[model samples]
Target: QTDQPVTFLLKDRAPATLSIAFGASILWLLIGLSSGIVSALRRATWIDKFSQGTALAGASLQIYFVGLVLQFILVDKLGWLSSPGYVSPNDYPMEWAQGMILPWITLGFLLSAIYARLTRAGMIEVMSEDYIRTARAKGLSTRRVNFKHVLRAAITPIITVFGLDLGALLGGAVITEYVFNIPGLGKLATEAVSNVDLPVIVGTVMVAAVFIVIANIVVDLVYMVLDPKVRLA
Candidate 1:
């Protein structure tokens, strides 16, 4: 709506969207991978059951609902966090992180639920392989066996999915930015649509597509580095 050109608008808003996506990516990967790995190693245990339960809940909940509930409990009720708003990290690193925590949690959680299930299935399958058994039989420490061997194998698909998810997030997290009152690309697109700013809307879509394509390329490179066989295959 501002008099600035679409390019300027995109450039201004790009950082916020990217930072949000990057933050969420870290949270989802960590939560999802850790939970999945642990659940797999401790199959049929209470930990596994709890993880599964949480994953189910996370997946089922809508993003808007999650954001509102978090705001109510964490911001409105507890009076712990400030209300969600975008603040540049360059201006105030600490405040930036604090501001982002809610959006990160909101965006991070739902995807983590899916990743948790995917990783769990992958881990279970990898753990049953002869190589896994052999690694354990070799008297390798649990940490080494799990991280060095098991995780490396089980994490491949997670990486692929993460690439696509990250790409989409980078494009714009509409509901999240809206709920959090952050003026990221998603919000820009939203406003553009409301204002019927065709240029901005098209610009955001193109930018998002670029991110997705780049993410896929990065994933393929990761695969090649992780497994030379992938390059050949």
Candidate 2:
């Protein structure tokens, strides 16, 4: 039996991978929120249909497939971005950003689709609520009603989904990291599985569980802030 412990293997690699996951999650959240809000606001229009169709299409494809297609178009055809690899942000900030662009997009695309659908559904439901009608009855501007009353109420479920998705991503976007050759926890876990390294696999699972718990805690705090009705006793 091999004597190497899981912690030793993950010692230097964990932070880099975690950083990439963190950055990508933030980018994904922003893109997803924007797409969702736009689609909801433009409901029943061509823009809404287009967003819906595009998100469905994106959701259908696997992450590796998306990653490869993006690589082909952006790197092979257009030569606009570099091929997948990792660079330390501390040492080479620009290169780090460049290297991460495709991975982020690849990981974020499906997530964006999910969030778009959730946001649209949530907004539609919230808009029809009595409070929304009361706001309109009070002569609130369309903008104010939508932004202040509608969005705040509609965003709860979206935030919940975002928390779960973010936790999953932090646990490691396995296919995305693999396709992009990122030496993140996902890749490490993959290697361990292939080699039947039980300790490393267990370690990765434990780490992922920790991240997920932390994400849930953060989400609960945010939920309380967003809706005053949530009482955390």
Please, what is the whole-model Cα lDDT of each candidate in the order they appear?
0.91, 0.83
Displacement of the residue 120 alpha carbon in candidate 1, Å: 1.1
Q: Encode model 2's per-residue lDDT on 1-233: one tens digit a residue.
A: 24777677776567657766777778767777788888999999999999999889878988888889999999999999998788788899898889988887777776788888888888889888998999899999999998888888988988888788778777876787778888888888888899898888888899889888999999999988988779544
Alpha-carbon TM-score of each model against the true structure: 0.94, 0.94
lDDT of 1 by residue, 92-209 (tens): 9988888988998888898899899998999899888999899899899989988888888888998899999999999999999888889999999989999998888899999999
In model 1, residue pairs whose N, Cα or C atoms come closer than 3 Å (at least 3 residues apart or on different chains), thus clashing, are none
